[model samples]
Target chain A: MKLSILKNELNEAIQNVSRAISSRTTIPILTGIKVDVTFQGVTLTASDTDISIQSFIPIEDDRQTIVQVERPGSVVLPAKFFVEIIKKLPSQHIEIEMQDQFQTLLRAGSAEIQMVGLDPEEYPVLPSIEEEQVFSVNGDLLKTMIKQTVFAISTNETTPILTGVLWNLQDGELKFVATDRHRLASRAAHIEVDTELRFHNIVISGKTMNELSKIIPDQNTMVDIVVADNQVLFKIDHVLFYSRILDGTYPDTSRIIPNQYKTELVLDTKKLTEAIDRAYLLSREEKTNIVRLQTKEDGTIEISSSSTELGRVTEQLEVKQFNGEALRIAFNSKYMLDVLKVIECEHIFLGFTGAMSPIIFKSTENVNSLHLILPYRTTT
Target chain B: MKLSILKNELNEAIQNVSRAISSRTTIPILTGIKVDVTFQGVTLTASDTDISIQSFIPIEDDRQTIVQVERPGSVVLPAKFFVEIIKKLPSQHIEIEMQDQFQTLLRAGSAEIQMVGLDPEEYPVLPSIEEEQVFSVNGDLLKTMIKQTVFAISTNETTPILTGVLWNLQDGELKFVATDRHRLASRAAHIEVDTELRFHNIVISGKTMNELSKIIPDQNTMVDIVVADNQVLFKIDHVLFYSRILDGTYPDTSRIIPNQYKTELVLDTKKLTEAIDRAYLLSREEKTNIVRLQTKEDGTIEISSSSTELGRVTEQLEVKQFNGEALRIAFNSKYMLDVLKVIECEHIFLGFTGAMSPIIFKSTENVNSLHLILPYRTTT
Candidate 1:
């Protein structure tokens, strides 16, 4: 490939594609980034069997010349070295030309780098995804939904299905759910989609979802998602991200969430987070991460944690509003902290069915998001 | 200790002393920070055997009331947990009280923490230095001198003396030098001190120097340094930093620097750094970090590095002035980058004796700082 491209645009594209490259891949060529140059634009692709990312740089973007082509060609260069060189290149524009025997020459300012490139044919071909069952969601909203639920996914590989976040769609409402058996997080959003389109058992690995979240544009642009039987493709602007769907069945977490609560309290999100965070420090020493919460009739809640070696942390937080019966519950403060951080609201509604039942946390302002954690049984 | 101290002041003091607390220490009491409250103010101290740091907060500083003493007492609190708790405390003013049996109660806003404290008597006492040899240097200058030379210290503990930076003071000139037998960095500053007071064999561990650098105030305030028999004490503002001197004779590095040069070139420090940095990226892949530099007769230089598996990178840089025999030299680009980064000057002078001899780098604007890296003997 012979072309002169804007250094900034190419650098950004390489970084996005590099997120998919893994050094642990047994296939040597998979460790490299495949570059394709054409009259239309330049495309960079990287994959590690599980996930593949492709980023394209158009010849012209918004009246600015991003790439100028002299010849069209294809080659795969080592991703590790190529990524580092491109980021440290010294010029505003860089010229890349394919030499004899798969050798590539890159010239930026006064620096010239000749990198050994592998034949593009040796690289695995990305599966051509058909947009038969495609749906679109706002990039920002999709990112929020992933953040709110992905962390709850189980990291244990023995139960492979639990390592992914379940995506369920019904009646134009798309919902995401993830649980590690101990805690569960669920978020749903109403989107403009075909009422007949429905899928309930689709699960994407939590790790892949995090990588996809990194590339998603911060802007509120719409992203098209194509779901296949075994693979899912996300078309985000000029980038195409493909992730393999995990096999096996995801357990139904809907029944785990408490439908009714005997005690509920509304508290300032920041104040409660601070109180729990302090209590978390002491509980972490004991390694149990157990923190006790008790509601008072005087419209206040007590949060405390103790360690045999470190002593105790106690805080009385005034609730904005309280209803139902007074109760005391013990839970993993780390899990509670994680749920509170993602609430993104001024106040949060904490509901308790009983000390042994699951405690549900929901944003006071947004009804679409919900999080639940199982209480720890302790003899007090 | 019963007192109400400004949270910000106490937090800063805790953070400074916490640097000296190492969890790897075998002594259990050393892992805790000792707090002594008097009518004057509060003092926080932590030590890991090698280094001890003490910070004192007065009853009032300037016009602000930093501390109000309720009672005089002493206690040792777990450094790891106490440091984290104080940082997240909710109030501007935190009240600390000593309860029965060495239990400490900390109240800040609505949060209350009762921590199990250790007996202050069990904590090791800091050595009282007689200050037979004393000198003062600006905190900013001392920090700069440490940063410029400390990176060259040998990290291998086999030769424990080389792991420390050699501090030599003579004739009102304070000099610091560190070398790993491959590269040597030396910095000297003329300070207003008694000319008769001289200590040439003192060496302090590079790790302790780094810890001391962290507590040095950014402002250009004078810091008094006392050199005792086996201890060095630095009074930085209200913080007293004590570092144990390494027991060994420091190797003389003056003979390693090239006094005469066969080739000398001057160039912009930043440009040379950028060129070397790019070449270092490729050399790093080879694991040898070898980069070649050749001076041209036309006042220019070429910097390049190659990997057998990854290919080559070459860059030609124009020199401001070149007046020496045309010669080619190979050296570790990583070492060259380190020296260039600390030059802190617009222009740098590169002095070379031959292709295999030591290469000296000095700031053209600063005469007191010098760096030398032994060149790699490569056949090509």
Candidate 2:
């Protein structure tokens, strides 16, 4: 195979596929990037069994000539050195030619390199995802959904299914939910889809979702997501991202969210976030990350935390509005911070059922997203 | 200690001294920062035995009232948590008061914190320097000299002295040299000082030099260097940086640099740097880091490297001048790259005595800096 590709185009493609290449992979061939030169364009693929990413550099682009293909062939080159070499090469134009026995030669400017290539056949094929249930979403909205819910996914691998975000579609509304048993984050969007289409319990690992978010251009581009049986494919322009779905049913959590709240507090998101962070400083010292919130008789909210080795922190913040019964409750500050950061609103609504029940936060500016955190029992 | 300090001023002071705090230090108190509030102002100090840094916050400044000292006392607070807490506090003005048993109360806005503080008596005392021998140098020049030589210091701890940069003063000139046996870097600067004062050898650990480089404001501030028997103190305004000198003497490296060269090759520093970097890509794959440089018949320099598992890379770089007999030499590309990165020159003079002799590089822009790299021996 022989091809002449622009350095910028090739480098961008390598970076996209490299997300799936890991040195920790058990399979030796999985450590290399598969390069294929065809009549249409050049394709680079990398995989770690958990996910596979393939990026194509077309022969001609509207902005510039990205690639020039002369022959057709395929080879897998060690990704560890290939990426570094390409980045440091001196020339704008690079020529790569495969010789006898899969030996690859890379020439850029006055420098020429011949890298030993492994058989591309040894690499696993792309997951056969039949675009049966495909839907497109705007890159910006999709990215926001990932950021709003992915952090709530369980990092503990004991419950493998909970480590993934559940995707649900009904009545033309697309929703994403993730929970680590301690906290839950949910985001919804009104997307155009087939009137008869309905998907439930389509769980995708948080790791894969994060990788997809990175590759998806943060512009107004449309990202097409295809689901077939146990595999999901996300196509962002010339890039294709595929991942396996978690094999388990999502637990019913609808009953956990209360329709009515015993107490509601409305406050500036930035002010509340800062108060919690200050209280977190002391709670973090205790290693439990526990902080208490109390509603004062003046309608102000009190946040405090204490540690035996350290000391204690107490903060009082005035809320815009406070009604119903005054309550005191303890919760993990980490969950609160994570929820606050994703909120893009000046004010937020905090609804509480009781001391032992879940506390929910809803952004006043963005009504489509909400976060719920479970309160921790306090011995005192 | 009782003080009302501007939040920004306190945060900046803590950051400056926190560089000396090490989580891996064996001494527990060394991991904390000692805060002393006197009638004048507040001082923060952190130490790791090898190095200690202290930064002072003045009572008043042109911009604002930086510190207001009410009572005088001292306490050592854990640097790790203190730095984070100070950065996240909500108020522009912060008041800190030391209560019973060294329990410190920090108030910012509506938030108040009580952090456990270690006894100041447990912290190590700062080294007392008489400033018997003192010289001041421009902060910019000092930082540049360090960058040009510190990377050559040996990382291996077996030869403790080689891990330090040797500072020698003579004939109104200050010189710095560092060598890891395989490579050596030398830099010299002429400065106005005591006409009759000179020091033969003073070795300061490279680690301390790096930390000092960071603390010295990037502007044109004058830094006073005070040398005692075993300790060196750098004073930048009210901030005092103290570091202990390494034991033993630095070897004389003057005799090894040859005056006459068998081959002299002058090349564009930027072009040669890029070419060598490309060759380095392949050499890194072989782990030997051996790259070949030979004078071609056309008067251009040919650079190449090959590996059994990988392949090979070859490049021809145009030389501005190549005289003497045609020569071939092999050297570690990593050392050359390190020197290239620090050189602020458009062209470089490469002097070669022989294939096995040490190669020397001198920047055409600056004559004060010189780098020497020992060549590698190959069977071929």
* DockQ for each model: 0.89, 0.74
Tens-digit lDDT track of model 2 for A234-301: 99999999889899998887888888999999999999999998888778878889999999887799
Ten contiguous residues minimizing lDDT sum, candidate 2 chain A? A123-132
State candidate 1's DockQ.
0.89
At residue B103, what lDDT does model 1 achieve? 98
Q: How accurate is candidate 2 locally (lDDT)?
A: 0.91
**Candidate 1 collision pairs:** none
Model 1 ranges with Cα > 4 A deviation: none
How would you encode candidate 1's per-residue C-alpha lDDT over A258-303 as one tens digit per residue?
7889999999999999999999999999999999999876778999
Q: Write the per-residue lDDT of candidate 1 for residues B1-380, one digit (tens) a residue.
A: 68899899999999999999997998989989999999998999999989999999999988899999989999999899999999999999899999999999999999999999999999999999997888899989999999999999999999999999999998899999999999999999999999999988899999999999888979888899999999999998899999999998998777777688888899988888999999999999899999999976666899999998898999999998887799899999999999998889999999998998999999999899999999999998
Regions of model 2 farther than 4 Å from truth: none
Tell me the deviation in Å of residue B223 in model 2: 0.8
Worst-scoring 10-residue span by lDDT in model 1 chain A: A252-261
